[model samples]
Structure formats: structure tokens, C-alpha cells
Target chain A: MSVENFLILGLGWAGIFLPTALGAIGSIVGCARAGQAACGALLDVESGYGRLVGASALPSSQTIYGIVVTMQLNRQVSVEASPGLFALGVLVGLALLCSAVLQGSCVASAINASKSKPEVFGLAIAPAAIVEGFAVFAFIFGLIISGGIPGTLAG
Target chain B: MPTATNYYMLVASLPRMPRTFEVEQVPISRLRLQQRLEMLNEEDTTTVQQMQEFLLWDRQHPDRTDTEVLQEYEQLMQRVRNVLARKIIVYRMDVRTITCGLRRRRLGMDPPSGVGQWVQAIRENWEHPDFRLARQHPWIPLVRGYMEAHQPLQTERQLLLAIWNQWTRLADRYYFSFETILLYLARWEIVDRWTRLNESLGRQHFESLLTEALGEHARFPQ
Candidate 1:
């Protein structure tokens, strides 16, 4: 496959997965804070669960997006395609997929934390942002690599 | 059969009890009228004539302590209280039902407006005729008490205490209505109103009364 094909696939994956990963990370932090505060008199355990679930659930949209892009790219590539471009596309897809996984996992962790101390929700945003930043970095890198390849070597 | 003569004698004897004369002492005459009205079961021509004469006398004599007049006023006030209580119950129930319906649809979403609408509705409806009439009945008794106290110059504490006592009486009735509504309605707005009203009257009024009383005492130094 051409460098253009690899870049398109990477962009699509990033577009779908990055948001999901960021949202998941944010949810995780929020849930953790909730858990920490759960011991107090004001803590509402049921509401905490609802909030945690809401936060964690946001990342699933990105996972579905990443999967669709991966399948599309796989169909576009053939055995005769340039190995270099194919390898690049595969690496970009992996990065995007990893980000989604990280987001989902973080969200899950936050949910667990919220169950114990519901008051920690305010502090969860930072870690989620950090994870999001990494996802963005990978996305930009994939886009740049794809853009640099010549058109004739694209497919 | 408590006659009109009995009511006249009761009113005439009021000046004897200096303490009871100041405040409303249950108006036994009016209570008798209410009881008589409730007990009138026969459609006898003589009883109907007596009833008509009683109502006519009540209307013609503005200053008369006729049992029928007092009973009429009592009935009017009772109707007002009932309507206000009913409106409060309906308003609270509607809010609770609507909130529950919304919750079922959204899974656990908090209502965006919170209790703001409920508060506004309550305050607005508070001026309804029924609520107004119910609120007015106690004012007469309060004024009567204050007048009978016959203090040439009232102390600030005395005035504050009197006002606070009246307010507390009114608040008690208001709370009764509120609690009745709350028994069936779980919306935050009703709860918010109860809390806000209690705090406003109880704490805020208490502080203001104390400050005013202290200020007066400082100036007079008695």
C-alpha cells in the first residue's frame, strides 16, 4: 500500500480512538476522587457509581471508531503492496489502539476508586489529560509520517 | 340548643377575663353557632324561619356578636385553609411525579432546574385567596392581645417577643401544611422552601429582633 493509504488509516484511527482514550482517562480520575471521598457523611454511594459509570462509558465510542478504521485499512492493503507503507500503517493503528486501551483501563480504575471515596472526583481530570496528551502525540506523529511519503510510493 | 341569648351573654362576659379578653379565647359563641348549623337536620318550617332571622340579624348588626356572623367568618377561613392546603399538596405532588418520570427516562440525571421552579410556584401561590384568608384570621387575635397589654410604651423585647410568638404560631400552621404535602411529594423544591422559610423566620428574624432590642436598650439604659 502507498504512504497516503497508511496516513489516511492512521488519521481515521486517531480521530476515533484519541477522544475515547482521553474521555476514559478523565473518567478514571473522576471516579478515583469519588472513591476517596466516599467515607464521609456527604458521600452518596449510588450517585458515585452512576458518575463513574458515565465517565468510563465515554471511551467505548472511540474503541468502535478505531476498530472500523483498522478493518478498512486491512481491506485496502494487498500482499503486493509496499512493505514499508504497510508497516507504517500497522504501527499507527497499534498506537491508536493502545491509546484506546489505556483510556478504557484508566476509566475502569477510576470507577473502582470512586466506589471507595467518592470525593476524589475533582482530582481525576489531570491524569486523564496526561493520557490524552500522549494519544494526541501519537496521532500527530502518524499524520506527519504519512504526509512525508511520496505519492508514487503510496500504493 | 345553645340560643342566641347564650352567645350574647358569652360576649358580655368577655371583659371579666382580662387575660382571655386580649387574645381570641376560642369564641365559644361562634363554636356554638357552628355546632348548631351542623346539627340542623330537620326541614321544619319553624327552624328554617329561625335560621333566616338569625342570618338577617347577623347581616344588619355590624357590631353584633351574633353567633351566625362569627360562624360565617370561621367557615370562610376554614375553606381558605383547606384550599391552600390542597393547592400545596397538588403542587408538590406534580413536581415529584414529574421528577420521577424524568428520572425513569434518563436513568439518574439530576433535573437541571433543581428546586427553583417549585420555590417560585409556592411563593406565587401563597397569595391565593385561601392562603390569604387563613393568614388573616390570627392577625385579629394578635392585635387584640397587643391592645389588651395596654402598655403606654412597649419595650423592644416585648414587641419582638409578641411578634415572634405570632410568627411562630403562623409558622406552625404553615409547617403543618408543608409536612402534609411533603409526606407524598419528594421533590427538593418543597424541602428547599421549608428550609428557606424556617431559616428566614427563625434565625434571621431572631437575630434582627435581638439586635434591635439591644440597640434600644443601649440608648435608654433602663
Candidate 2:
């Protein structure tokens, strides 16, 4: 393929895969870290099986958010829409990924703190909530931009 | 009420069972008064000291479970607050006391106030022999700051009941306190202003007590 065609094809694949892949990456790493913290926490607490489990899963939401955004961006990878896809895909994907990982760390810390001192569990989750805000922004922005893309099916 | 076995023991020991029964009932009230008086003598002692005494109590009363101790404690607490007559307070207080004992703190996500000061104070005195501080928790500073800022001017036992009522009214059922919050509260025997506050404002405005006490630093609603 010619260089131009090759670049277009690359952009097309990057548009769909990058957001999904990066989001999953973020969720995986984030959940894993939080889960590790949760496991450590379980040893000390008399009982909080549900809360600890729920906290570790908090970072996993970014992955679903990423998937929804990616599905929205998936469409005819024509040259006309390629640039939009690239920008939305890469930026939103990275944001979701970063937010997820950061949220995971926050949740892990929250779980650990709550395990020892459960009263602070609500407050400890505040940082994670703040981090979730960025992911919501990314999701909304992706949704808006996807609407503007020509010839793409509704996501 | 003495059991049949206890009655036999009284008869075997005293020979005059009816007189012994009258003397026992009178002395039981006196014994309680004496115990309360003794407790008042060291009311200013630290949590570590209290914890030690509790442990000794446990050891001495090998046949009594923690539930029995808690029941006895709750009876004393009820008398102190004059709530034995209030049926509503009694029912709610029972649940709160049970929940507090089981959970060791209120259940919620809102961070307690004054966590920063609490963490700082704990770190400074981390070498104390009674309590163990978990240094690795990431939210330690935040938790400490929240508790220090929000902790009520009451005894540890009262604080448990306060949060029980406060958090329940907030309708955020799944609240909890950091272990350090309990540790810090246990360390002191602060005079309770809640009783006065409740008298003036009624029990419903317990949130206002937190607000009034916290002044500016109280961020959480309950």
C-alpha cells in the first residue's frame, strides 16, 4: 500500500482499538492494585467482605466507560472521519486509562483505610469519585465528537 | 434473683437465709455505689489504663462473656444519661450500642473531621504500648485529620452512640470510623456536652452539635 493509504489504515485501526485497549489496560492495572490492597485489608478486619470487594471493583468502571466510548467511535474508517477518530480515540482513551488507574490507587487506599477504620470509608472513596469525574468527561466528549462524524452509525 | 443453686449456697454459708437475703439486696446496691465511686477515682486515666482495667475485669470474670460486660456497661450508661425511662431512646440506644460494639465505629463514607491532627498526634505518640497504629494505610493522614476535626467532646462510649444516631439519620447506613478514631477517643475521658445539647435542642438536632462544635472545619453533614 502507498504511504498515504497505509497511514489512513493505521488511523482507522487506531481509532477503534486504542480506546478499548487502553481502557482495559487501565482497568486491569487499577483493579489488580486495589485487589491487592483489599486482600491485605481482609486479614485485619473482623468482617467487611462486601465493602472490600466492592472497592476493588470500583476501578473497573473505567474499562466499561472506555468500551462505551470506543463503540461510539467505531464506524466507517474513511479518510474524512479518520482525523476525528484519531483525536477522540487517542485522547479519550488515554484519559479513561489514566483515570481508571488513578482511581484504582485511590480505591485501594480507601479499602485499606476502611478495613482498619471503616468510618472513613466514605471519605476515602472521595478521591476515587473525583477521578471518576475525568472519565465521565472523557466519555461525554467522545459521545459528542462521535455524533459529528459523517457516515458513522449511531453509537 | 438468686437461682435455686445460689439459694442453697446462701443457706449453707449463712445459716440464716432470710436475713442474708435482705442483707445481700441492700449490700448489692451499696456495692454498685462503691464500684462507681472507685471508678470516679481514676476517671481521668488514659485509654491504655482503662484498657488494662478492662482486660483485668475480663480475666477476673472468666465466666462472663463480653456480651455480659457490655450489657452491664450499657446499664450503667443508661443510668448516667437518665434514659432508662425513655422507651424510644432505650430501643434506639440498644441497637446503636449493639451496632457500635460489633462495628467498632459508625458506618459511612463521609470522612470524619480532624483526621490530620489525629494522625499527627498518633505519630508523635506511636510508641505507646497499648494500641498499634497501622502506618501503611494510604488514607491515614486524611482519616486522622477528619476524626480530629469532627470528633465530639464526649466519652468514647458516648461518641459511638452519637455517631450511631447521627449516621443513621443521615440515612447513609454503611458508615464506619478509622481504627485511629477509636484509638484517639479511647485515649481521653472528655466531659460530655451532648447531654446538655440534647436537653436544649432535643435529640433530633444532634447534627447541629457537630456543626456547633466543629465551627468551620466540619465538612461532613452527619
Candidate 3:
């Protein structure tokens, strides 16, 4: 593919990935706030299974978004033409995938925690934020590579 | 004619019990009224502290089941209700107790006397930890302000509206908190046995008390 074509494609992918990642971050933070409130309320007074059930249900959407973005990036890379570019793309994609998987697992654990203690929901947030860091690194790296590829490669 | 002091001491000194199945057998209506009284009396040092202690113990001992903790809480609440029912002096004292619990705290050390003090007191009480957590949202201050400012008097219609508004706000907070916790749990996959057991117990105690309180007004309308 031409350099412009590759650049355009990469930019398109970035466009989708960036916004979704940002949105996921927002949603995660909102979920965290909700978790804090839930735990606080549970501490103040118990609300039974209803409280646990409700608190456990709020984090899945963001996890799914993270997974989808990384998977899509994996699909976008071309291995035959440029091995280095392809490898970098795969690395970034894997980074994103790992973050999504870890974050998703954290969310699940948090739900389980809420079911029993609802009070400890606040404690579940640290893991989710940690996973977000990996996603951020992968995203920034991918953007830089995509930006540079257009300039260095011959059409 | 047990004095408030006597009732206080009894509740304070009541021995802790192990898990029991009596909770399931107990009529929800009776439990509901008793729970309401217990919740209101949460401000009472004797009762609130005990409840807090029970919760703390359950947290420490993770082997306890939700069903067991809830049953014990119900029994305690039943005992409290029975005491309040049997003694006229205690009952009247409880009325004062409820008023005090329900009374708003003054924003300033010395709020203007009369209606203003009462209004401010309600505002303060609403903002207190127990009632504040029930609503679990940023909107409490605004809603509380409106309720305090309106001070609907005399008419049952106005009173109902005020109560409804307060209830709605509390319900919103309750649901929001629930949703938030669910999201975190789903993310974390936290399947620890002890944490789950404690949570279930805490939830049971909370619900049982709320149901007991709400049921009373419905069953016995003046």
C-alpha cells in the first residue's frame, strides 16, 4: 500500500481507538464514583442483596470497549510488507489487549466483592486504574508509530 | 413504667446471640416497624454502637453466613420493639427520641429560635452520615435546602409531598450506590469467601430494619 494510504488507514484506526479509550476512561471513573458511593452507603446501613446486585453490575461496558479497540488494532496491521511496523503494531495491540483483560477481570472481582460486602467496593478501583495505565501507554505508542510511519516509509 | 435509662441499659447490655432461623419465621410487618425504630434509634448511642459492633464482629469472623447475621439482627430488633411496646414511659421517651433523631441540627451553634431552629435541625440531621448515605448523591444539598426552606405545615398534602421528595432522593442515592458497586465488582472478580459473607450479612440487617419500619405505618394508620 502507498504511504498515504497506510497513514490514512492508521489515522482512521487511531480516530476510533482514541475516542473509545477516552470514553472508557470516563466511564471507568464514573463507575468508580458509583462504587465509592455504594460502599459508603453499605457502611452507613445495609441494603441487602439489592445493594450487592446493583453495585456489581456497573463496570462491564467499559471493559468491552477496551477489548474491542485493541482487537481492532490487531486486525489493522499488515505483516508481509513491513515486518517491523507489523511487530510494533502487534506489541501495542497486545498491550491494549492485556489491559482490557486485566481490567475486565478486576471488574468481575469487584462485582463479587459487592455481592458480599458492598462496603469494600471502593477497594476494587485500584486495579482498574492500574490496567488503564497500560492501555494509555499502548495507545500513545501506537499513535507515535503511526505518525512517524508516513514520513519514513517510501511510497 | 420503665424509664428511658432502663430501656437504654437493657439494649446496651443485651447479650449477643449466634445465628438462628427465627428471622425467616418472623412476620415482615412486625420486623418492618421494629427496623424503622431501630434505624431511627441508631442515633441513640446504646443501640447504634451495638449494631456497629455486631457488624464489626461479623467482618472479623468471615465464617458467619448472611442468613445467620440477619436472624440475630431481627431478634435484637424484636426485643427492642417489645420493650418499647410494653413500657408507656419508654414508649413516650421513644417518641421524644424519634423527634430528637428526626430533628434537624442547627447550622450555627445558636440558630434563630422557633420554626427556624426546627427547620435547621432537620437540615442538619438529614445531612448527618446515616441519612446522608441513604441518598448517596450530590443532589442532597439542593434537595435538602428546598425541603428546609419550604417548611410545609398543617396540611397533610404538603407533608406528604415533603416526605415523598425526601424518600425519592434517598431512593435515588440507594440505586446509584448499588449500580456503582456492581460495576466495581464485575471489574475486580473479587471472590473472597470472608468478604462475601460479611457483605451478605450487612445487607440483610439493613433491609430487615428498613422493611420493619416501613411496614408499621401501613399496618396501623391513625
What lDDT score belongs to each candidate, Candidate 1 first?
Answer: 0.38, 0.53, 0.41
lDDT of 3 by residue, A1-155 (tens): 78876775565455435435544554565455444434433432335635543643354344455455444443334323234344455555455545554554455445444444556767865676676776676666665655544323322
Chain B, per-candidate TM-score: 0.17, 0.17, 0.19
Candidate 3: list runs displaced more than 4 Å: A1-81, A151-155, B1-222
Question: Which stretches of candidate 2 lie above 4 Å from their native place?
Answer: B1-222
lDDT of residue A54 for candidate 1? 58
> Model 2: how large is the Cα RMSD against the reference?
24.0
Error of 2 at B116 (Å): 34
Candidate 3, backbone clash total: 43
Candidate 3 chain A, poorest ten consecutive residues by summed lDDT: A146-155
List, residue by residue over A27-127, the lDDT tens digit for candidate 1.
Answer: 44433333322222122244544565456554444344434433333323332333434554556545555555566445444443444456775565356
Candidate 1, residues B12-105, lDDT tens digits: the string is 1221111111232322243443333342233322333333342233126666433554465344334433343333433333333233333332
B160-195 in candidate 2: lDDT tens per residue?
344334323332221122222222222211112223
DockQ of 2: 0.00
Docking class of 3: incorrect
- Ten consecutive residues with minimal summed lDDT in candidate 2 chain B? B8-17
**Residue B103 deviation, candidate 3, in Å?**
65
